[model samples]
Target chain A: MKNNKTDFIQGNIACVEGAIVAGCKFFAGYPITPASEIAEHMSERMFQVNGTFIQTEDELSSIAAVVGSSWAGAKAMTATSGPGISLMQENIGLAIATETPLVIVDVQRGGPSTGSPSISLQGDTIQVKYGSQGEYQVISIAPSSPQEMFDYTIWAFNIAEKFRTPVFVMADVMVGHMREQVEYPEDYNELEIFDRKILDDPDSTEGRFLSTEVAPMPIFGNGFKANVTGSTHDEFGWRNVSDPKVMDNFIKKLTNKILNNKSEIIRTEKEYMEDAEVVLLSYGSVSRAALETVHTAREKEIKVGSYRLVTVWPFPEKEISKMSENVEKIIVLENNLGQIYPYVRSAVDGKAEVELLSPSVLGEFFEPNYILNKIKEAK
Target chain B: MLKDIEHPLQKYIRPGTNYTTCPGCGNGILAQSTLRAIKNLELDFDNIVFVSGIGCAGWIPSPSFNTDVLHVTHGRAIAYATGVKLTNPKLKVVVFSGDGDLSAIGGNHFIHAARRNIDLTVICVNNRIYGMTSGQAAPTTPKNSKTTTTPYGNMENTFDLSDLAKSAGATFVARWTTYHARQLTKSIAKAIDKKGFSFIEAISQCPVHYGKVIGMRNDAPSMMKEFKSKSIHINKIDSLSNESSDDKIIVGELVNENEKAELTDLMQSLRTEVGTDG
Candidate 1:
């Protein structure tokens, strides 16, 4: 810990700084509580760097503006809470269907409406995956601390640009607003910046081939005629509402690009799970508490371990299934009411005992005693 | 502006039978004026992107135009238009949608884009009723207008487009009626030439939907006469005497000829500030 260089920063500020280091050049967002700090950080940094920051009138415009900025050859992003995220769903659908590269940070708070502003909750897990009208796969990440907020934001933009789809940094009030020490990399020179894919020859007919989902991307201002549309489209970006083959190919490739690459996208961390009887599965802010609980249990000789999920959207099913295969039991913990618990319990398949722990909105975190008691029960 | 008149769009309309407009509809006038403005401005045909959302007015960007047209999801024209404009900042981005599409469902985008003053021309057709959905109450519908949903008169107050734009930080805002085709056409041309967010609210007639309810669907020529008579300048909004019974005022050019920093300009400034570290 002393060897690593650490600078204290809030979770949202770290996210903004991380995006800048990751080469994010455009930010469009509406100011929402608990998440407004992301916009505020962007507002100041956008002026400090060669990036664009815009405060839209609402969440719809915020996401729309980011979509526009992304098309302009910038790594664009936006941040919002529950209500703003709801407003952004349609545009998010458009981004997914059109294969636009963007990063949306949803700093969730308690509510279906304007719930607790300062409080935290993980209620948007299902919505983040399936909130849009159609069935589209998404890449989502859950950062458990300020450091992860910074690191994961960089990874989020990289994945978005690589896959040419919208990626989610699904954080909550706890990790979004929390202040903690985050260490910057020793050599910042190693981070790879992924720019918008470009057409090599603007004049060649091959340049037009960049319109398809799997085709090479044509960057804007490259003097190419690349027509893009949100409708069911062909490789040429022309509307093909009547062609089933075109629809099938477009949807297949759009979903396949991310689905086939899940191994590379899915990331997880495991700690002392090989011989432990009880394993805790957690993500976002709850993982931090689970880590502490596991440490306490380890000292007490209860043989408890933890599995922390960094990338949560594809749900890290393969990693969890592999990690928990030998464990005697698994306990899932979160701030929302069983939002992700069912997935965890179903994955373990009764070979090991499965349980859930969801904290109420009363405070910042759950008591370590509660988690310790659950681990004892699992034994 | 004769030297500015362009082709493609100007040459698209065929001399044939009326297609689908209602018998006394004002959409024809709005579409015709838009066409005339495109011709008058001599805008590049290939670079002209006409974006529309789901509504009766959304059809304007469909078969009606020869240039690139994007018919997107409901209340999302502005979003797609932003995409188009940002990708090719040199392109002329024109958005056409109904009052409900822009002010009601799309109001969040409407005000935000206006506030940012993005360099896009938004031509909103305020027909006072949702025509495609049949007679439903719209954002601009009069409070007393009876519609399918509001059989007992609309209790919600109508949205005043000009006022909303002014408060939301639009650089240019204007209102024109279908009967003011020539003026509306010139206004549209001016908006296209302006370098910031320009909005033109074209008050239209929804005859099949609203006409049968208000008993105003007689002759198409007579409907034009009413539009010509009732339309007034927005500046006289305050000076108009309350004594007149014919007080349904359709004002024109509420706010015009103003300049502000565009979103691109702001981004450029930010880039300068962020410097080499980025």
Candidate 2:
């Protein structure tokens, strides 16, 4: 155990600290159980750092305010639980449509709406991706522990800034409120920060007019006349609501921008996919249990491997597809009712069998023996 | 799609079109007042941002002004305006919303923005009744007036526009009926010139909707006549007492001349104080 001052922190606490270290200067969020601590800790730390903390009227405004702050050129973020995350969906779509880089922390609790606040669940994995209207790719990170949470949050901001897209730190109640020792980076200034690429052409007045596939976003105070809109738009930021070509181009460019950069955003951990017939897939804090089970099963001479998803959004479909070729069956363990299972099952396309283990159905988590039994059943 | 981003307002209003209010209807006069203010301030034509919510008043900025205008979601003009302003604080942002749009559905954002003292001008066209939705009883609708939503006498008390602004933390709050054309123009100019959040509530007329519902003709002349007769202007604090006639409606600068630290100035000051800590 680390000392009290330099001791292990909860995943949520680490998320807050990570954002602070990442130079996030603005935070706007509403207080919801299981996620309120993020806001509370942020409020105090932000004040100390002379950063901005706005307790918005609701989750919608919370996200909207962060968007506003981000446009103001501050690295900004917001945190919420299930219902609050639902309210933020429209603004999330707005963020995507506007190409404003912002990070959102969704501390999952059991819920369709205000389900169990105290319990831990990973039900929002699919919701975080598909809850918003429209077709778009998203970047989400699942942290398995406090240290992982701290590290991934920094990664989330970097990805958001680099790609100019919203990033998600999908965590749950147990990881959020839990306390554990966390090591701080010795020199935070040495950490790399990614800022959006600004237009540099001096002679071309047409440079600011983005007719290209991916429109480059201009900083607000910069002299460029950038029009940010939610409506389907042309490159100049004008509302091209009537044009299908504009809509198609807008969607195509946005999709391609993230898709083409898959090598940069895709992250996963492959334990024993080399020679395993049974593979257990998990994310967030639940991956710890899965890893433990995988090691225990290995002791009994069972060829079981565990694959942990660090970035859940751009889905990691390629890695899963590759693993599906050799693995006879894939068992997915999460804290929710099979949210990511469909993606795993679809990724393999019946090339390998898929099974789901949800805490809502079974319990908080599967014990090592229980996971081994599930793996045995897969055989 | 328009090739050039002309203010929808300038493109929509035709020379001989009577689609707008009567010549004297407060909407036309308020529209003129807005243009006059914008011109007097000599705001950069391309950088001026006009955002309007849903209402007849909301349409005022769409077709007539040759500037950057956003026809945003209903009661969400402020939300969009905040985005525009924060995106480029140098860009002049003005929100054009109706009484119902600002006071009812957009009430939360209204008070919250004012409380923060964000630097922008919010021109609220308070016609007493909801004109676009056809004379529904609005938040600013006078009690006991007949409208589509209130066939019987209205039971709910109406909101006082100036009072609401004062309490909401606006550095400058003023009210003038469309009948007070010069006064309305001057108030708008001052509001625009103010460094902090400023609000100018223009009481206009809804002849086709609220007027007809309460036995007035849909004609523009009669509506203008009603507005002029009922309009009252307050030049001083005691102007209310001098013109305390129930038959006449109150107008003029209700609250004027106060300044607070604008949001950006405060942030910059904090940045300076914190220096490297920031």
Candidate 3:
């Protein structure tokens, strides 16, 4: 099973396979719709790999446990949907402030609150970015297919470890449950894996996690007298709420660490955009329909192309602007009621007229026929 | 002369570490008792991790311990400590928390951790009120006590935390007040050495907050004298059925059992059964 083989498995299972290959040693998750399979597979898989898995009492404990495990020097992760994300946001902020590297897979179901559990929607794109309070940034990767689910999870872990921050895989029910071919690699050890920098010198005060270039984690149980906290702190990890200077540096260093490295972090896909009039922009499962519409429009001699966002956050602002420059209009296609349209529109910055095209019925993925008709109307 | 003489346990404290507690706050007392127990147990600082949630008690080990410490979010210390202990079972993880933190917001994590019988020691400083945010009534606030929130006297009975730990399947349960300093240190040592879930409810005083609300003199001696007077030893169980003993603090070890398997060892046995033993 470690060698190369093709298996038709659900998108959620692909995530389990991906995490295991990425050196994830601990998983703590509560069962939720569409995301339960990830936890189910991890429960069995972790033992085989000599890892730890726990079905925690709730989402809060699941995320808290993941953070704890990560600090104790294990690659850790958890899976949940919209409601679970809501519960886990507090500890998510803790993970952010303490600079703990962990992965969270959000298999988004429709929701303002526990909306369709069995259905799929891209409702949590901005939620993943802003749900955790405070002035900090995150890396989120959206996967459009089961194969991408397997591949992007590894990328998510690598990005999380490299930056020493929480990374999210913005999965949805469609990609989570839909069975497709996933390729297990020939040698799991051959995959690119990134680990967080550990403090080589235990006596140095410099590895206290305040650098703009990131700092090595003074992980627990290794004799480093590390002070881990969610409060505003100086380089020593001691709470320093009164100092104006400490607050300024903490916010800027944390935010800029990701912003400075956005180039290496962001990934986008462009197709047939060299000569185009209209472009369909989307991410995750809705992109499947958008790509189909582009192919269908090409047969009819319509100069329409498609742009997809692989890395949903760090926004791909420049790429979106570039895509919009050569096109007449850019239609932001998504499953929900334009959750990502504002970001896409702002990125376009009026280079072209931007419009939002959602599924005819929410929770149902966009239909290519519906999109093509919209392209015909817009043109 | 007292300041010139270095404390024997000063090596375990971070240099220049200040207790920062108020004159009458018993947090310092419990803090010393915990450290004293660890020092006597001869555990290396490198092998122990202390997790404390948000409260006055949460400040016990954070920024003070020469050992690794996590001053985590309110109500989540037990959950986070679970991750640390289960991930590396060799590390002795201790959660130093307050009644308001462990019994209110983190109550679920406490119960479940005890239920799972994980190999961790938890020291709960039950100050009977929310001292950090001034004096609000807590789940452990004494019945009919006046608190900041309970202006008309508390309408609710307090949670018997030691009894709750016993019922929730903790393998070791002990209760003491700051007045019982020697016994508290001894119990902490015993709890640390215990295999499964070990909980120590250190009933302490908040002289500035809970003390004033209870109509006592605003001083540590006042509270200590009251603790010495009102507490009944666990050996006096026959008095528990009497109405007069209802309000008495039962101070001593309540439960110590070794029948169930500790979680880390259980996990190891699971690996053995799965044929993935390493």
Top candidate on TM-score is 3
Task: Rank all candidate structures by their DockQ, best first, as comma-separated numbers.
Answer: 3, 1, 2
Mind giving the per-residue lDDT tens digits that candidate 3 earns over A218-331? 989777888888889877787889998999988988889899999999988888888989999888988888889999999999998888888888788887887778889999
Q: Write the per-residue lDDT of candidate 2 for residues B70-106, one digit (tens) a residue.
A: 5545577776566556545677778899988898988
For candidate 3, the TM-score is 0.98
Per-model CA lDDT versus the true structure: 0.78, 0.76, 0.90
Q: Can you tell me which runs of candidate 3 are displaced by over 4 Å?
A: B1-4, B239-241, B275-278
Chain A fold similarity by TM-score, each prediction: 0.93, 0.94, 0.98
Check candidate 1 and list the clashing pairs: A48-B273, A48-B274, A49-B274, A50-B271, B5-B39
Writing each residue's lDDT as its tens digit, candidate 3 over B215-243 gives 77468898898899989998987857788
| Separate DockQ for every predicted complex | 0.30, 0.24, 0.72
Candidate 3 has an interface RMSD (Å) of: 1.8
lDDT leaderboard ranking: 3, 1, 2
Better of 1 and 3 by lDDT: 3
TM-score of 2: 0.85
What shift in Å separates residue B99 of candidate 1 from its native position after superposition?
1.5
Q: Which stretches of candidate 1 lie over 4 Å from their true place?
A: A1-6, A198-254, A299-302, A359-364, A367-369, B1-32, B45-50, B62-73, B79-91, B108-118, B153-157, B166-169, B216-222, B229-254, B259-278
RMSD of 1: 5.0
